[model samples]
Target: MENNTWSDDQPIVSIQNVHKSFGALEVLKGVSLDVMKGEVICIIGPSGSGKSTLIRCINALNDIQAGSIKVEGLEVHDSKLDQLELRKRVGMVFQQYNLFPHKTALENVMMAPIKVLKQPKDEVEKRARALIEKVRLQGKEDAYPGELSGGQQQRVAIARSLAMNPDVMLFDEVTAALDPETVKEVLVTIKDLAEEGMTCILVTHEMGFAREIADHIYFTDRGVIVEHGPPDTFFDNASDPRTREFLSQIL
Candidate 1:
């Protein structure tokens, strides 16, 4: 299930005129965007604005009722799409640190590669340890989730996502749950990943971080993208009044 069809010119993730709903409530309406390889796209908006839903759609965690989402040239909602294969290509980190309580940090990172991908234990362990270190948790590998702070647990979660070696990473307000003092560490780790050219799309409230790291920023509101542009222009001279109003409150 390698992605041989994707190319440098093609977007890694493409959402075209996408529409989504939860039972009777429509959450996303005709949204469209494209993320190129190694580009960091930051999505910002008020709560209930479909920021999270849009990213979830990209990974097929939430099915779209209309429009299309393509990742590496494969339709995300296609009937024949391989769920496991799609997950391997598009890694995601959620707001909550969903690490296994019983497993140590290293084991949590190693679990998926061994259980799902069927990689050998020795190889998985080696990579998991490196990933733990990559998230700056080298010494805490043996600690259980309960033994770690929120930031540490979140870093472990990020490392766990990296274990799969995804081509694109979707972050859904990953720092929203962390304490103020601890948020910087988790953000620094993500910043490092983006700088290293891992294609990243994030739904975040950290305006400062988004401004500093994102190649482009999209302001989504009420299920639609009000405006989007390069970080400097978006922050300095927002064209849409809706975007400007949103920025006024948050920034």
Candidate 2:
């Protein structure tokens, strides 16, 4: 970082010595990481190991008290940064799916681009249709969230995020609420996105899926990253005993 050569090819996300607290409890303690363009980073650990908090902080869902998080060269921790625009660049899909319950699938996908970005309705619809198809929900656009299965609804949520044309996508336990059979469909769509070289940060418990598509894996614990490396190395021979224990319970 000191060489400054990376300035020409700045990282898509740069988190430096980030720390966050809630009242009396410290959640993130001096955590730091960098994500290069198109990199797929899978964050995994025990339930309370700060996995979800870290990803949420990336897009500013929870503000950090110390250190800095920069996305596409803008410091997120800075008060001057445009949070609304930042979210446009860094999209997030949560475990709850957060789709509009009343709106049909296509409308949920089309609403943001039209209302937030102020794009032409015709143009937004064109792209929304393509995104719906991309998520393998081609024929379900007319269905409401209540009519679709959990997996289908989540896919629509994913498509809604993609409609924003984000530079990076964050997945927070995306398949956690789905039935076992429903999980595969959502995973397949995410795998396709990874293959297409979209910069992604996934906080998930699906060990097999994470091992398959992640370019690098970060194992965090006690508000710090304890281990990080390529899938083969870290999964096979993690540097820490705590990482081994966590993987054993889930894997």
Candidate 3:
């Protein structure tokens, strides 16, 4: 199952003993993980368990107070590191669809590449249109954000991220805010991306989806990783009592 596009020896995203705090509330406590190229790693845990905070650290969305994170060998927290370069390599889709309300779906997908990357409009538009179809939203290209359903807007958000040509995609509870009926559509889009050999890190409450898609599953608790393993072992034979307890409640 090796992907020829990326190597397996060196990790693409690395985190070591990371600690993050928001004022007096300490979030991530000595969290550490490594994401290999073309791997889908799912982070599952109770709310406020630092799952979201940890992924945010990988792309420098949240600053770490201690330890280090590196993406493609560049230090994420380095003061001299180029933020735009980091973002271009790592794309993130949030729980909320943050599309510009005034822009059409195609315009939203095309905005960043055209404005930030200075790509030619025609080229960006072409890719944007293709991405729109990739996410199964071909006919809605001209629809405004306000006109689309939550799931459609989220699929558009995924396409917008894809327009940047990111090497790694981070999904932070992307389906959490959608209606029950619409959640499956967003999950299917993500599953398709993972199958296409995208390196993905997901913070999710969807245990079934995690078990189905993840090469490895990480369970976090109390701001630290309680247990991590392949879905088969993690779900049926978790070593940590906390992991078992959490799974019992959820699964």
lDDT of each: 0.94, 0.92, 0.93
Q: After superposition, how far is residue 55 of candidate 3 from its true place, in Å?
A: 1.3
Best by lDDT: 1
The best candidate in terms of TM-score: 1
Q: Global CA lDDT of candidate 1, please?
A: 0.94
Which tens-of-lDDT digit does each residue in 65-122 have in candidate 3? 9999988877889898889989999999999988899999999999999999999999
lDDT (Cα) of model 2 = 0.92
TM-score of 1: 0.98
For model 3, name the residue pairs that clash: none
TM-score per candidate: 0.98, 0.96, 0.96
- Model 3: worst 10 consecutive residues (lDDT sum): 1-10
Candidate 2 vs candidate 3, lDDT winner: 3
Question: In order, how many clashes per candidate?
Answer: 0, 0, 0
Q: How far is candidate 1 from the true structure (C-alpha RMSD, Å)?
A: 1.2
User: Please, what are the lDDT tens digits per residue for candidate 2 over residues 129-216?
Assistant: 9999999999998999999999999999999999999999999999999999999999999999999989999999998999999999
The model with the greater TM-score, 1 or 3, is 1
- Worst ten in a row by lDDT for model 1: 1-10
